[model samples]
Target: MEFTETLLPGVGVRYDGQSRDGQPIAIVVAHDGDVEIVTYQRTDPDAVQYRLELAAHAALAVAELLGSPRVSARLVDLTREIPGLHTRRLVVAPGSRYAGRLLGDSKARTRTGCSIVAVVRGPDVIAAPAPDFTLLAGDTLIAIGSERGLEALAELLGLTPDDPVPVMTAPV
Candidate 1:
């Protein structure tokens, strides 16, 4: 979930990170508005495994498909209506203990008192996912709970507050 971003001077920005499967990946945003998603081999970091090129419009479409805006709006509205309620996005990263495990195995709700309302994987959103649902690497969990509970859930997912991973939450 943590990535390093480097400014490319006259170009744009380059984000480097490791994939959920331990493969190196780089995302480059060009000044011309194009985006490239590249994956490298585990053995050779510089060797290209595959590359996906997206135009500005295509990138926006992909973002919409991921439902960031819609989900954020709904979470914001819910938080605004309730006191001490918050929402956060928790990513299942590589090496996570829960990766490839069942949602019920984590006992997230029983342990942290946080409800995982949705699971966003690639272009698919599994709303109200069952406890039997399997969690895969790269899956983004949309959880709603108190701040303390959410922080606990993050720790359960092997993330600390100091991690660079973005914990997007609605304004209290």
Candidate 2:
């Protein structure tokens, strides 16, 4: 549909969590990157959903429209979505060999979709660290990537997504 999905600066806002029934609701983002929730008495939320579907139908009616998602060569070539594309955090122990394994074995990140953005060691911080940067004890790794990527890192780092990091002293 010639959707400008590459419009990297776009944003989406919605109410989520177990509190909501998992309905797809739409919210607005201002030109300044602020999120505004969609509420009642303003635009009919249900009607808005219907209108979006109708717009999709109209788009489908176009003879030249392509419904399938296609990856752009530039996106794949640059891997623009891998670096600062998304972010997650990992608090590793003061010292661990996992640091070597992560940067040494990038395929795990490539496959799972996570990239180490930076490492916070105590009061000092290193941003855009090289792949060879060795991790020290009490190092906080700032990572970014897809959900699966985050999960893979968690597994390798031996911590749950929300668990407090314990000292990794179990002999590597």
lDDT string, candidate 1, 25-98, tens digits: 99887766588999987688678789999997787677677665346446756896898999988999877777
The 10-residue segment of model 1 with minimum total lDDT is 163-172
Which candidate has the highest lDDT of all? 1
Worst 10 residues of 2 by lDDT: 68-77
| Over 4 Å off, model 2 | 1-85, 94-102, 105-108, 159-172
Candidate 1 global TM-score: 0.55
Model 2 C-alpha lDDT per residue in residues 1-172, reported as the tens digit of each score = 0112123244332332221654444444333334333323236544433212223234324312443221122223245445535455576653343644445433435445566766766545577678667665467677766656666666667543355444321111
Query: What's the lDDT for all of these models?
Result: 0.80, 0.47
Candidate 2 clashing pairs, residues 3+ apart or interchain: 93-138, 94-136, 94-137, 94-138, 95-137
TM-scores for all predictions: 0.55, 0.39
